[model samples]
Target: MKLIRYGEPGHERIGVQINEVNYDVSAFGGDYDESFFASNGLARLDEFVKANAGNLIAIAEEERIAAPFTRPSKIVCIGLNYKDHAEETGATIPAEPIIFMKSTTALAGPNDQVMIPRNSKKTDWEVEFGIVIGKKASYVDESEALNYVAGYVLHNDVSEREFQIERGGTWDKGKGCDTFAPMGPVLTTADEIPDINQVGLWLKVNGKLYQNGNTSNLIFSVPFIVSYVSQFMTLLPGDVISTGTPAGVGLGFNPPIYLQAGDIIELGADYLGTQRQEVIAFQKN
Candidate 1:
Protein backbone atom coordinates (compact mmCIF):
# COMPACT_ATOMS: atom_id res chain seq x y z
CA MET A 1 0.00 0.00 0.00
CA LYS A 2 1.23 3.54 -0.76
CA LEU A 3 0.70 5.56 2.39
CA ILE A 4 0.68 9.39 2.30
CA ARG A 5 0.04 12.41 4.45
CA TYR A 6 -1.60 15.43 2.83
CA GLY A 7 -3.38 18.69 3.62
CA GLU A 8 -1.56 21.81 4.83
CA PRO A 9 1.99 21.84 6.21
CA GLY A 10 1.23 21.08 9.84
CA HIS A 11 -2.32 19.91 9.28
CA GLU A 12 -1.72 16.90 7.03
CA ARG A 13 -4.17 14.00 7.16
CA ILE A 14 -3.11 10.40 6.77
CA GLY A 15 -4.15 8.80 3.50
CA VAL A 16 -3.83 5.71 1.34
CA GLN A 17 -3.63 5.63 -2.43
CA ILE A 18 -6.08 3.27 -4.09
CA ASN A 19 -6.18 2.89 -7.87
CA GLU A 20 -4.40 6.25 -8.44
CA VAL A 21 -6.63 8.08 -6.01
CA ASN A 22 -5.84 9.21 -2.46
CA TYR A 23 -8.34 7.99 0.13
CA ASP A 24 -8.52 10.12 3.24
CA VAL A 25 -7.98 7.79 6.20
CA SER A 26 -7.29 10.31 8.92
CA ALA A 27 -10.71 9.72 10.52
CA PHE A 28 -9.46 6.32 11.62
CA GLY A 29 -7.89 8.31 14.49
CA GLY A 30 -4.13 8.25 14.12
CA ASP A 31 -1.37 10.28 12.54
CA TYR A 32 1.09 8.50 10.25
CA ASP A 33 3.76 8.56 12.93
CA GLU A 34 5.89 5.97 14.78
CA SER A 35 3.02 4.84 16.98
CA PHE A 36 0.90 4.17 13.93
CA PHE A 37 3.44 2.01 12.14
CA ALA A 38 4.80 0.30 15.27
CA SER A 39 1.43 -0.77 16.66
CA ASN A 40 0.29 -2.44 13.43
CA GLY A 41 -1.89 0.51 12.49
CA LEU A 42 -1.15 -0.31 8.87
CA ALA A 43 -3.10 -3.56 9.26
CA ARG A 44 -5.91 -1.67 10.97
CA LEU A 45 -5.81 0.85 8.14
CA ASP A 46 -6.16 -1.97 5.65
CA GLU A 47 -9.28 -3.20 7.39
CA PHE A 48 -10.68 0.30 7.48
CA VAL A 49 -10.03 0.73 3.79
CA LYS A 50 -12.01 -2.43 3.06
CA ALA A 51 -14.91 -1.58 5.34
CA ASN A 52 -15.25 1.97 4.07
CA ALA A 53 -14.14 1.48 0.51
CA GLY A 54 -17.25 3.04 -0.93
CA ASN A 55 -17.28 6.03 1.41
CA LEU A 56 -13.61 6.96 1.43
CA ILE A 57 -13.08 10.61 0.53
CA ALA A 58 -10.74 11.47 -2.28
CA ILE A 59 -8.14 14.17 -1.67
CA ALA A 60 -8.05 17.24 -3.88
CA GLU A 61 -5.21 17.60 -6.34
CA GLU A 62 -4.06 20.87 -4.84
CA GLU A 63 -3.67 19.67 -1.27
CA ARG A 64 -0.25 20.28 0.29
CA ILE A 65 1.63 17.23 1.50
CA ALA A 66 3.69 16.94 4.65
CA ALA A 67 6.37 14.31 5.09
CA PRO A 68 4.68 10.88 4.96
CA PHE A 69 5.61 9.98 8.53
CA THR A 70 5.18 12.40 11.40
CA ARG A 71 7.97 13.49 13.76
CA PRO A 72 10.69 10.86 14.06
CA SER A 73 13.01 10.17 16.99
CA LYS A 74 16.14 10.64 14.87
CA ILE A 75 17.51 11.03 11.35
CA VAL A 76 20.73 9.04 10.96
CA CYS A 77 22.87 9.26 7.86
CA ILE A 78 25.77 7.25 6.49
CA GLY A 79 28.54 9.13 4.73
CA LEU A 80 30.67 7.92 1.81
CA ASN A 81 28.98 4.52 1.60
CA TYR A 82 29.37 4.38 -2.15
CA LYS A 83 32.71 3.35 -3.59
CA ASP A 84 32.71 5.76 -6.50
CA HIS A 85 31.47 8.63 -4.34
CA ALA A 86 34.29 8.00 -1.88
CA GLU A 87 36.82 7.92 -4.69
CA GLU A 88 35.48 11.18 -6.14
CA THR A 89 35.91 12.91 -2.80
CA GLY A 90 39.49 11.63 -2.48
CA ALA A 91 38.61 9.57 0.59
CA THR A 92 39.27 5.92 1.21
CA ILE A 93 36.28 3.59 1.49
CA PRO A 94 35.80 2.85 5.16
CA ALA A 95 35.74 -0.63 6.65
CA GLU A 96 32.76 0.57 8.67
CA PRO A 97 29.94 3.10 8.18
CA ILE A 98 30.64 6.85 8.65
CA ILE A 99 27.58 8.08 10.48
CA PHE A 100 26.07 11.53 11.09
CA MET A 101 22.83 12.98 12.40
CA LYS A 102 20.49 15.64 10.99
CA SER A 103 18.20 17.44 13.32
CA THR A 104 14.62 16.29 12.89
CA THR A 105 13.52 19.89 12.41
CA ALA A 106 15.24 19.86 9.04
CA LEU A 107 12.50 17.51 7.83
CA ALA A 108 9.98 18.80 5.26
CA GLY A 109 7.71 17.52 2.53
CA PRO A 110 9.20 16.30 -0.74
CA ASN A 111 7.90 19.18 -2.82
CA ASP A 112 8.83 21.90 -0.38
CA GLN A 113 11.31 24.58 -1.38
CA VAL A 114 14.89 24.02 -0.21
CA MET A 115 15.61 27.14 1.82
CA ILE A 116 19.21 28.10 1.13
CA PRO A 117 20.43 29.35 4.50
CA ARG A 118 21.59 32.93 5.09
CA ASN A 119 25.04 33.82 3.69
CA SER A 120 25.27 30.39 2.08
CA LYS A 121 26.73 30.03 -1.39
CA LYS A 122 27.63 26.37 -1.72
CA THR A 123 24.40 24.43 -1.35
CA ASP A 124 24.58 21.00 -3.00
CA TRP A 125 22.27 18.08 -3.66
CA GLU A 126 22.47 14.40 -2.86
CA VAL A 127 19.73 12.03 -3.91
CA GLU A 128 19.60 9.05 -1.57
CA PHE A 129 17.45 6.15 -0.33
CA GLY A 130 15.92 6.69 3.11
CA ILE A 131 14.90 3.79 5.37
CA VAL A 132 12.08 4.15 7.87
CA ILE A 133 12.31 2.07 11.02
CA GLY A 134 9.26 0.03 12.02
CA LYS A 135 10.39 -1.27 15.38
CA LYS A 136 12.77 -0.60 18.25
CA ALA A 137 16.14 -2.07 17.36
CA SER A 138 19.26 -2.44 19.51
CA TYR A 139 22.30 -4.66 19.13
CA VAL A 140 20.61 -6.27 16.13
CA ASP A 141 22.52 -8.72 14.02
CA GLU A 142 23.13 -7.67 10.42
CA SER A 143 21.06 -10.68 9.36
CA GLU A 144 17.96 -9.37 11.09
CA ALA A 145 18.35 -5.68 10.31
CA LEU A 146 15.89 -5.55 7.43
CA ASN A 147 13.22 -6.92 9.76
CA TYR A 148 13.16 -3.65 11.64
CA VAL A 149 12.58 -1.51 8.55
CA ALA A 150 9.07 -0.44 7.65
CA GLY A 151 9.87 0.91 4.19
CA TYR A 152 11.88 3.25 1.98
CA VAL A 153 11.48 6.74 0.50
CA LEU A 154 13.34 9.21 -1.72
CA HIS A 155 15.52 11.72 0.23
CA ASN A 156 17.51 14.75 -0.82
CA ASP A 157 20.57 15.03 1.43
CA VAL A 158 21.01 18.76 0.69
CA SER A 159 24.31 20.15 1.87
CA GLU A 160 26.27 23.38 2.14
CA ARG A 161 29.75 22.35 1.00
CA GLU A 162 31.63 25.27 2.49
CA PHE A 163 30.20 24.67 5.95
CA GLN A 164 30.53 20.92 5.53
CA ILE A 165 34.16 20.61 4.44
CA GLU A 166 35.88 23.96 4.84
CA ARG A 167 34.24 25.89 7.69
CA GLY A 168 32.86 23.18 9.94
CA GLY A 169 33.93 20.75 12.60
CA THR A 170 31.32 18.24 11.50
CA TRP A 171 29.16 17.59 8.43
CA ASP A 172 26.02 18.21 10.49
CA LYS A 173 26.59 21.97 10.35
CA GLY A 174 26.02 22.05 6.63
CA LYS A 175 23.32 19.39 6.70
CA GLY A 176 20.77 20.36 9.31
CA CYS A 177 19.38 23.56 7.80
CA ASP A 178 15.60 23.92 7.78
CA THR A 179 14.00 22.34 4.71
CA PHE A 180 17.24 20.54 3.82
CA ALA A 181 15.83 17.07 4.23
CA PRO A 182 13.02 16.67 1.69
CA MET A 183 11.48 13.21 2.01
CA GLY A 184 8.87 11.18 0.19
CA PRO A 185 6.08 11.20 -2.30
CA VAL A 186 4.87 8.39 -0.12
CA LEU A 187 6.31 5.69 2.09
CA THR A 188 6.28 2.30 0.39
CA THR A 189 6.16 -0.91 2.38
CA ALA A 190 9.16 -3.24 2.11
CA ASP A 191 7.13 -6.09 0.64
CA GLU A 192 6.39 -4.04 -2.47
CA ILE A 193 10.03 -4.04 -3.49
CA PRO A 194 11.46 -7.13 -5.13
CA ASP A 195 15.15 -6.36 -4.62
CA ILE A 196 16.43 -3.50 -2.52
CA ASN A 197 19.99 -3.62 -3.73
CA GLN A 198 19.16 -3.45 -7.43
CA VAL A 199 16.77 -0.48 -7.36
CA GLY A 200 17.48 2.24 -9.94
CA LEU A 201 18.07 5.56 -8.20
CA TRP A 202 18.36 8.71 -10.25
CA LEU A 203 18.20 12.50 -9.95
CA LYS A 204 17.60 15.37 -12.36
CA VAL A 205 18.10 19.08 -11.88
CA ASN A 206 15.85 21.30 -13.99
CA GLY A 207 15.20 18.33 -16.32
CA LYS A 208 18.90 17.59 -16.78
CA LEU A 209 20.05 14.25 -15.45
CA TYR A 210 22.91 14.49 -12.98
CA GLN A 211 23.00 11.60 -10.55
CA ASN A 212 22.25 8.28 -12.23
CA GLY A 213 23.13 5.19 -10.26
CA ASN A 214 21.64 2.17 -8.50
CA THR A 215 21.65 0.70 -5.01
CA SER A 216 23.66 -2.18 -6.49
CA ASN A 217 26.70 0.09 -6.23
CA LEU A 218 26.32 0.82 -2.52
CA ILE A 219 29.33 -0.11 -0.36
CA PHE A 220 27.09 -0.80 2.65
CA SER A 221 23.67 -2.37 2.02
CA VAL A 222 20.46 -1.47 3.84
CA PRO A 223 20.44 -4.41 6.21
CA PHE A 224 24.04 -3.81 7.17
CA ILE A 225 23.44 -0.10 7.86
CA VAL A 226 20.38 -0.74 10.03
CA SER A 227 22.13 -3.40 12.04
CA TYR A 228 25.36 -1.45 12.21
CA VAL A 229 23.77 1.67 13.69
CA SER A 230 21.68 -0.33 16.17
CA GLN A 231 24.82 -1.52 17.91
CA PHE A 232 25.55 1.98 19.21
CA MET A 233 22.12 3.58 19.60
CA THR A 234 18.56 2.37 19.90
CA LEU A 235 16.75 2.58 16.56
CA LEU A 236 13.19 3.36 17.48
CA PRO A 237 10.12 3.19 15.32
CA GLY A 238 9.89 6.18 12.89
CA ASP A 239 13.62 6.82 13.01
CA VAL A 240 15.03 7.47 9.52
CA ILE A 241 18.36 6.16 8.27
CA SER A 242 19.49 7.53 4.91
CA THR A 243 21.82 5.17 3.12
CA GLY A 244 24.60 7.09 1.34
CA THR A 245 24.33 8.27 -2.24
CA PRO A 246 26.13 6.91 -5.27
CA ALA A 247 28.39 9.01 -7.52
CA GLY A 248 27.42 12.12 -9.56
CA VAL A 249 26.63 14.55 -6.78
CA GLY A 250 27.24 18.26 -7.34
CA LEU A 251 30.29 17.98 -5.09
CA GLY A 252 31.82 15.38 -7.42
CA PHE A 253 31.85 17.63 -10.47
CA ASN A 254 34.95 19.24 -12.00
CA PRO A 255 34.19 22.76 -10.77
CA PRO A 256 31.56 21.51 -8.33
CA ILE A 257 28.10 22.80 -9.21
CA TYR A 258 25.73 23.97 -6.50
CA LEU A 259 22.02 24.70 -6.30
CA GLN A 260 20.71 28.19 -7.02
CA ALA A 261 17.26 29.69 -6.79
CA GLY A 262 14.79 28.38 -9.38
CA ASP A 263 16.53 25.03 -9.75
CA ILE A 264 14.27 21.98 -9.65
CA ILE A 265 15.36 18.59 -8.33
CA GLU A 266 13.57 15.34 -9.13
CA LEU A 267 14.55 11.95 -7.72
CA GLY A 268 13.24 8.49 -6.90
CA ALA A 269 14.04 4.85 -6.23
CA ASP A 270 12.40 1.70 -7.57
CA TYR A 271 9.15 0.92 -5.70
CA LEU A 272 9.72 3.95 -3.48
CA GLY A 273 8.06 6.52 -5.77
CA THR A 274 9.30 9.90 -7.05
CA GLN A 275 9.38 13.50 -5.80
CA ARG A 276 10.30 17.01 -7.05
CA GLN A 277 11.31 20.23 -5.29
CA GLU A 278 12.13 23.77 -6.37
CA VAL A 279 15.17 25.47 -4.86
CA ILE A 280 14.90 28.93 -3.33
CA ALA A 281 17.33 31.11 -1.40
CA PHE A 282 16.20 32.13 2.03
CA GLN A 283 15.18 35.78 2.15
CA LYS A 284 16.36 37.94 5.00
CA ASN A 285 13.76 39.87 6.98
Candidate 2:
Protein backbone atom coordinates (compact mmCIF):
# COMPACT_ATOMS: atom_id res chain seq x y z
CA MET A 1 0.00 0.00 0.00
CA LYS A 2 1.24 3.47 -0.95
CA LEU A 3 -0.24 6.26 1.22
CA ILE A 4 -0.33 9.91 0.19
CA ARG A 5 -1.71 13.28 1.25
CA TYR A 6 -2.93 15.82 -1.29
CA GLY A 7 -4.84 19.10 -1.26
CA GLU A 8 -3.57 22.61 -0.51
CA PRO A 9 -0.65 22.26 1.90
CA GLY A 10 -2.07 22.43 5.44
CA HIS A 11 -5.53 21.63 4.10
CA GLU A 12 -4.39 18.32 2.53
CA ARG A 13 -6.66 15.25 2.43
CA ILE A 14 -5.71 11.62 2.84
CA GLY A 15 -5.44 9.39 -0.24
CA VAL A 16 -3.97 6.16 -1.61
CA GLN A 17 -1.89 5.52 -4.72
CA ILE A 18 -2.39 2.33 -6.70
CA ASN A 19 -0.53 1.71 -9.94
CA GLU A 20 0.39 5.43 -10.16
CA VAL A 21 -3.15 6.90 -9.88
CA ASN A 22 -4.22 8.53 -6.60
CA TYR A 23 -7.73 7.97 -5.17
CA ASP A 24 -9.55 9.74 -2.39
CA VAL A 25 -9.77 7.81 0.88
CA SER A 26 -10.61 10.64 3.23
CA ALA A 27 -13.68 8.64 4.24
CA PHE A 28 -11.32 6.46 6.29
CA GLY A 29 -11.46 9.19 8.90
CA GLY A 30 -7.77 9.41 9.70
CA ASP A 31 -4.64 11.34 8.87
CA TYR A 32 -1.41 9.32 8.66
CA ASP A 33 -0.24 10.56 12.04
CA GLU A 34 0.75 8.85 15.32
CA SER A 35 -2.81 8.27 16.54
CA PHE A 36 -3.79 6.64 13.25
CA PHE A 37 -0.73 4.34 13.09
CA ALA A 38 -0.79 3.37 16.79
CA SER A 39 -4.26 1.90 16.26
CA ASN A 40 -3.41 -0.39 13.32
CA GLY A 41 -4.16 2.22 10.66
CA LEU A 42 -2.30 0.54 7.81
CA ALA A 43 -4.19 -2.73 8.14
CA ARG A 44 -7.49 -0.86 8.49
CA LEU A 45 -6.60 1.32 5.51
CA ASP A 46 -5.87 -1.74 3.41
CA GLU A 47 -9.26 -3.20 4.36
CA PHE A 48 -10.93 0.06 3.43
CA VAL A 49 -9.31 0.08 0.01
CA LYS A 50 -10.35 -3.51 -0.57
CA ALA A 51 -13.94 -2.87 0.44
CA ASN A 52 -14.30 0.46 -1.39
CA ALA A 53 -13.02 -0.99 -4.65
CA GLY A 54 -14.28 1.18 -7.55
CA ASN A 55 -16.17 3.57 -5.28
CA LEU A 56 -13.05 5.48 -4.22
CA ILE A 57 -12.97 8.88 -5.89
CA ALA A 58 -10.06 9.59 -8.23
CA ILE A 59 -8.16 12.77 -7.44
CA ALA A 60 -8.09 15.35 -10.23
CA GLU A 61 -4.92 15.43 -12.34
CA GLU A 62 -4.17 18.98 -11.21
CA GLU A 63 -4.35 18.40 -7.44
CA ARG A 64 -1.17 19.16 -5.49
CA ILE A 65 0.83 16.41 -3.73
CA ALA A 66 1.78 16.79 -0.08
CA ALA A 67 3.91 14.62 2.19
CA PRO A 68 2.70 11.00 2.28
CA PHE A 69 1.82 11.36 5.95
CA THR A 70 1.52 14.16 8.49
CA ARG A 71 4.68 15.41 10.19
CA PRO A 72 6.27 12.90 12.52
CA SER A 73 7.11 13.60 16.16
CA LYS A 74 10.76 13.77 15.15
CA ILE A 75 13.10 13.37 12.21
CA VAL A 76 16.27 11.65 13.50
CA CYS A 77 19.22 11.28 11.16
CA ILE A 78 22.42 9.20 11.08
CA GLY A 79 25.58 10.98 9.94
CA LEU A 80 28.41 9.34 7.98
CA ASN A 81 26.51 6.09 7.58
CA TYR A 82 27.95 5.48 4.16
CA LYS A 83 31.63 4.77 3.42
CA ASP A 84 31.89 6.84 0.27
CA HIS A 85 30.03 9.71 1.90
CA ALA A 86 32.29 9.62 4.94
CA GLU A 87 35.42 9.52 2.81
CA GLU A 88 34.25 12.31 0.49
CA THR A 89 33.56 14.66 3.40
CA GLY A 90 36.90 13.91 5.12
CA ALA A 91 35.41 12.06 8.05
CA THR A 92 36.59 8.85 9.69
CA ILE A 93 34.45 5.73 10.09
CA PRO A 94 32.48 6.20 13.27
CA ALA A 95 32.80 3.83 16.20
CA GLU A 96 29.14 4.57 16.93
CA PRO A 97 26.28 6.07 14.92
CA ILE A 98 26.38 9.89 14.76
CA ILE A 99 22.82 11.03 15.45
CA PHE A 100 21.19 14.43 14.87
CA MET A 101 17.65 15.84 14.99
CA LYS A 102 15.99 17.94 12.31
CA SER A 103 13.21 20.30 13.38
CA THR A 104 9.73 19.08 12.42
CA THR A 105 8.81 22.47 10.98
CA ALA A 106 11.30 21.90 8.16
CA LEU A 107 8.98 19.40 6.46
CA ALA A 108 7.71 20.28 2.98
CA GLY A 109 5.92 18.59 0.11
CA PRO A 110 8.08 16.66 -2.34
CA ASN A 111 7.60 19.00 -5.28
CA ASP A 112 7.65 22.26 -3.35
CA GLN A 113 10.33 24.85 -3.90
CA VAL A 114 13.44 24.64 -1.67
CA MET A 115 14.16 28.03 -0.15
CA ILE A 116 17.76 29.25 -0.08
CA PRO A 117 17.92 30.82 3.39
CA ARG A 118 18.83 34.50 3.38
CA ASN A 119 22.59 35.27 3.75
CA SER A 120 23.42 31.66 2.85
CA LYS A 121 25.90 30.56 0.21
CA LYS A 122 26.63 26.95 1.16
CA THR A 123 23.21 25.33 0.80
CA ASP A 124 23.63 21.78 -0.50
CA TRP A 125 21.74 18.56 -1.22
CA GLU A 126 21.74 14.98 0.08
CA VAL A 127 19.60 12.18 -1.25
CA GLU A 128 18.74 9.62 1.40
CA PHE A 129 16.32 6.81 2.31
CA GLY A 130 13.92 7.41 5.23
CA ILE A 131 12.09 5.02 7.56
CA VAL A 132 8.69 5.69 9.11
CA ILE A 133 7.88 4.06 12.45
CA GLY A 134 4.56 2.27 12.93
CA LYS A 135 4.57 1.74 16.70
CA LYS A 136 6.33 2.83 19.84
CA ALA A 137 9.89 1.49 19.91
CA SER A 138 12.27 1.70 22.83
CA TYR A 139 15.33 -0.46 23.59
CA VAL A 140 14.41 -2.79 20.68
CA ASP A 141 16.74 -5.55 19.64
CA GLU A 142 18.42 -5.21 16.27
CA SER A 143 16.82 -8.47 15.14
CA GLU A 144 13.32 -7.21 15.94
CA ALA A 145 13.58 -3.71 14.52
CA LEU A 146 11.83 -4.31 11.23
CA ASN A 147 8.64 -5.29 13.04
CA TYR A 148 8.19 -1.68 14.14
CA VAL A 149 8.49 -0.14 10.70
CA ALA A 150 5.47 1.23 8.82
CA GLY A 151 7.02 2.31 5.52
CA TYR A 152 9.93 3.84 3.63
CA VAL A 153 10.29 7.29 2.03
CA LEU A 154 12.58 9.33 -0.22
CA HIS A 155 14.31 12.26 1.51
CA ASN A 156 16.39 15.17 0.30
CA ASP A 157 18.59 16.08 3.31
CA VAL A 158 19.10 19.68 2.26
CA SER A 159 21.86 21.44 4.23
CA GLU A 160 23.84 24.67 4.63
CA ARG A 161 27.54 23.91 5.13
CA GLU A 162 28.48 27.16 6.84
CA PHE A 163 25.83 26.90 9.52
CA GLN A 164 26.42 23.17 9.95
CA ILE A 165 30.19 22.97 10.06
CA GLU A 166 32.05 26.29 10.15
CA ARG A 167 29.71 28.41 12.27
CA GLY A 168 28.37 25.69 14.45
CA GLY A 169 28.06 23.76 17.58
CA THR A 170 25.83 21.12 15.96
CA TRP A 171 24.53 20.16 12.51
CA ASP A 172 20.94 21.06 13.41
CA LYS A 173 21.57 24.76 12.85
CA GLY A 174 22.04 24.10 9.14
CA LYS A 175 19.64 21.17 8.84
CA GLY A 176 16.46 22.61 10.34
CA CYS A 177 15.85 25.54 8.05
CA ASP A 178 12.41 25.96 6.41
CA THR A 179 11.95 23.83 3.28
CA PHE A 180 15.11 21.89 4.00
CA ALA A 181 13.52 18.50 4.35
CA PRO A 182 11.56 17.82 1.13
CA MET A 183 10.06 14.32 1.31
CA GLY A 184 7.76 11.82 -0.33
CA PRO A 185 5.64 11.76 -3.43
CA VAL A 186 4.48 8.50 -1.81
CA LEU A 187 5.17 6.41 1.29
CA THR A 188 5.47 2.75 0.30
CA THR A 189 4.59 0.23 2.98
CA ALA A 190 7.31 -2.23 4.04
CA ASP A 191 5.61 -5.18 2.33
CA GLU A 192 5.93 -3.59 -1.12
CA ILE A 193 9.69 -3.65 -1.14
CA PRO A 194 11.27 -6.96 -2.20
CA ASP A 195 14.64 -6.60 -0.43
CA ILE A 196 14.98 -3.38 1.52
CA ASN A 197 18.71 -3.81 1.99
CA GLN A 198 19.45 -3.83 -1.73
CA VAL A 199 17.55 -0.77 -2.85
CA GLY A 200 18.94 1.68 -5.43
CA LEU A 201 19.03 5.41 -4.63
CA TRP A 202 19.90 8.37 -6.85
CA LEU A 203 19.74 12.15 -7.22
CA LYS A 204 20.09 14.79 -9.93
CA VAL A 205 20.41 18.57 -10.04
CA ASN A 206 19.31 20.58 -13.07
CA GLY A 207 19.07 17.32 -15.05
CA LYS A 208 22.70 16.44 -14.28
CA LEU A 209 23.34 13.30 -12.24
CA TYR A 210 25.22 13.92 -9.00
CA GLN A 211 24.34 11.07 -6.63
CA ASN A 212 24.30 7.48 -7.85
CA GLY A 213 24.40 5.00 -5.01
CA ASN A 214 22.72 2.04 -3.35
CA THR A 215 21.61 1.00 0.14
CA SER A 216 23.88 -2.00 -0.15
CA ASN A 217 26.78 0.37 0.46
CA LEU A 218 25.58 1.51 3.85
CA ILE A 219 28.08 1.06 6.69
CA PHE A 220 25.40 0.27 9.23
CA SER A 221 22.29 -1.77 8.35
CA VAL A 222 18.68 -0.60 8.94
CA PRO A 223 17.85 -2.94 11.82
CA PHE A 224 21.02 -1.97 13.66
CA ILE A 225 20.26 1.72 13.22
CA VAL A 226 16.71 1.33 14.52
CA SER A 227 17.84 -0.71 17.49
CA TYR A 228 20.70 1.67 18.25
CA VAL A 229 18.44 4.73 18.19
CA SER A 230 15.71 3.10 20.23
CA GLN A 231 18.16 2.52 23.07
CA PHE A 232 18.44 6.26 23.70
CA MET A 233 14.87 7.50 23.16
CA THR A 234 11.43 6.20 22.32
CA LEU A 235 10.55 6.32 18.62
CA LEU A 236 6.85 7.02 18.29
CA PRO A 237 4.55 6.06 15.48
CA GLY A 238 4.96 8.55 12.57
CA ASP A 239 8.53 9.45 13.57
CA VAL A 240 11.03 9.31 10.72
CA ILE A 241 14.66 8.09 10.70
CA SER A 242 16.71 9.11 7.67
CA THR A 243 19.30 6.37 7.07
CA GLY A 244 21.98 8.73 5.63
CA THR A 245 23.25 9.51 2.16
CA PRO A 246 25.87 7.98 -0.12
CA ALA A 247 28.64 9.96 -1.86
CA GLY A 248 28.18 12.89 -4.26
CA VAL A 249 26.78 15.67 -2.09
CA GLY A 250 27.89 19.10 -3.26
CA LEU A 251 30.04 19.30 -0.13
CA GLY A 252 32.13 16.43 -1.55
CA PHE A 253 33.22 18.32 -4.68
CA ASN A 254 36.78 19.52 -5.35
CA PRO A 255 35.97 23.15 -4.54
CA PRO A 256 32.44 22.35 -3.35
CA ILE A 257 29.39 23.42 -5.35
CA TYR A 258 26.23 24.80 -3.73
CA LEU A 259 22.58 25.41 -4.53
CA GLN A 260 21.46 28.76 -5.93
CA ALA A 261 18.08 30.16 -6.94
CA GLY A 262 16.52 28.45 -9.98
CA ASP A 263 18.29 25.11 -9.37
CA ILE A 264 16.18 21.97 -9.44
CA ILE A 265 16.75 18.82 -7.35
CA GLU A 266 15.26 15.42 -8.16
CA LEU A 267 15.75 12.24 -6.17
CA GLY A 268 14.25 8.79 -5.50
CA ALA A 269 14.80 5.30 -4.16
CA ASP A 270 13.66 1.94 -5.50
CA TYR A 271 10.01 1.23 -4.56
CA LEU A 272 9.85 4.48 -2.54
CA GLY A 273 8.98 6.81 -5.49
CA THR A 274 10.53 10.14 -6.53
CA GLN A 275 10.57 13.89 -5.69
CA ARG A 276 11.38 17.14 -7.57
CA GLN A 277 11.89 20.59 -6.04
CA GLU A 278 12.85 23.93 -7.56
CA VAL A 279 15.28 26.12 -5.62
CA ILE A 280 13.84 29.54 -4.71
CA ALA A 281 15.49 32.54 -3.00
CA PHE A 282 14.35 33.34 0.51
CA GLN A 283 12.42 36.53 1.20
CA LYS A 284 12.50 38.35 4.51
CA ASN A 285 9.40 39.80 6.12
Best by TM-score: 2
In model 2, the runs with Cα more than 4 Å from the true position are none
Candidate 1: regions farther than 4 A off: none
Q: List the residue pairs that clash in candidate 2.
A: none
| Candidates' C-alpha lDDT | 0.88, 0.94
Summarize candidate 2's per-residue lDDT along 1-285 as a digit string, tens digits.
999999897799999999999999999997999999899999999999999998999999789899998989999999999999999999999989999999898899999899999889999999999999999999999999999999999999999999999995999999999999988989999999998889999999999999999999989899999999999999999999999999999999999999999999999889988999999999763
RMSD of each: 1.3, 0.8
lDDT of 1 at 274: 79
Q: Candidate 1 residues 62-130, lDDT tens each? A: 888778889799999999999999998788899999999988989999888888999899999898999
